[model samples]
Target: MADQPEEVRRLLEAIDALAAIEDDATCASAVTALLNDWPTHHARLREIRQERVLALRDSGRTWKEIGDLLGGVHASRAQQIAKGLRGTKRPVKGADE
Candidate 1:
């Protein structure tokens, strides 16, 4: 893929290496290694995405536009990401409250 990041390339290579293993023990070990390392990679990826979303917002892009570019994520959700808010649901304010 064009312009793929080095981390992503390494991840793909690791996946390929995992897939090529025929020995069950080796496969298990590889899978364990991947699982062990996944959280760090996942966090890094999330941080990168948040940074990009903020950058896009700062570059005169509307949340709706960013959401569209992000494969139809809701504008509010995109805004939350740009603001570094986790996707946790909060109680809505009702008229009675």
Candidate 2:
């Protein structure tokens, strides 16, 4: 099935709303609403985001570049997530892999 642009808009709107909320409980509920309303959209969004990260790395871009292109997340965190998703045996510093 093809993804609709409106669905992505809705997901972004919902995330924006959640981020605007001050209370943790309200934020949680907002996220739940977003998940229930657009589970497939969120899943697709995640896939797209992951692909972007991978492509940035493949293009010889640094983790900082990838993170900046995707959003404002830290470079190290983006690198870690990318490595984990690719099943790389990254050093976890004692925690379970």
Candidate 3:
């Protein structure tokens, strides 16, 4: 849970609210709806993270510095996340598909 995002907290709240549903089928349906949307939610979180990375990079921070601020990943990994390198790489997958 150390690296969990803030969005997860909100999602947990939504899941918890499902407890009020008495019908099993209805409750399961609601839960499924929430779970199904997770990918989109995750992508949004990533987009926000990337924005922060760009802001940091614009402020003259190096990938190593960014990695340090982010959880200690390698510099190249940080660079890839912040500003994707050129080549024949595929586009990043978004939550909405």
* Superposed model 2: Cα runs more than 4 Å off: 1-37, 83-97
lDDT, model 1, position 88: 80
Clashing pairs in 3: 40-95
lDDT of each: 0.88, 0.74, 0.80
Ranking by lDDT: 1, 3, 2
Q: Write the per-residue lDDT of candidate 1 for residues 1-97, one digit (tens) a residue.
A: 4577797799788788898999989999979988999899788878999999999999999999999988799999999898778888677779458
Quickly count the clashes in candidate 2: 0
Q: Which candidate leads in lDDT?
A: 1
Candidate 3, superposed: residue stretches over 4 Å from native: 1-27, 84-97
Q: Note the residue pairs that clash in candidate 1.
A: none
lDDT for 53 (candidate 1): 97
Model 3 lDDT tens row, 53-77 = 8999999999999999888978887
Write the candidate numbers in order of decreasing TM-score: 1, 3, 2
Error of 2 at 13 (Å): 8.3
List TM-score per model, in order.
0.72, 0.46, 0.59
Q: Flag regions of model 1 displaced more than 4 Å.
A: 1-17, 89-97
State the local distance difference test value for candidate 1. 0.88
Model 1 poorest 10 in a row by lDDT: 87-96
Lowest lDDT 10-mer window, candidate 2?
A: 80-89
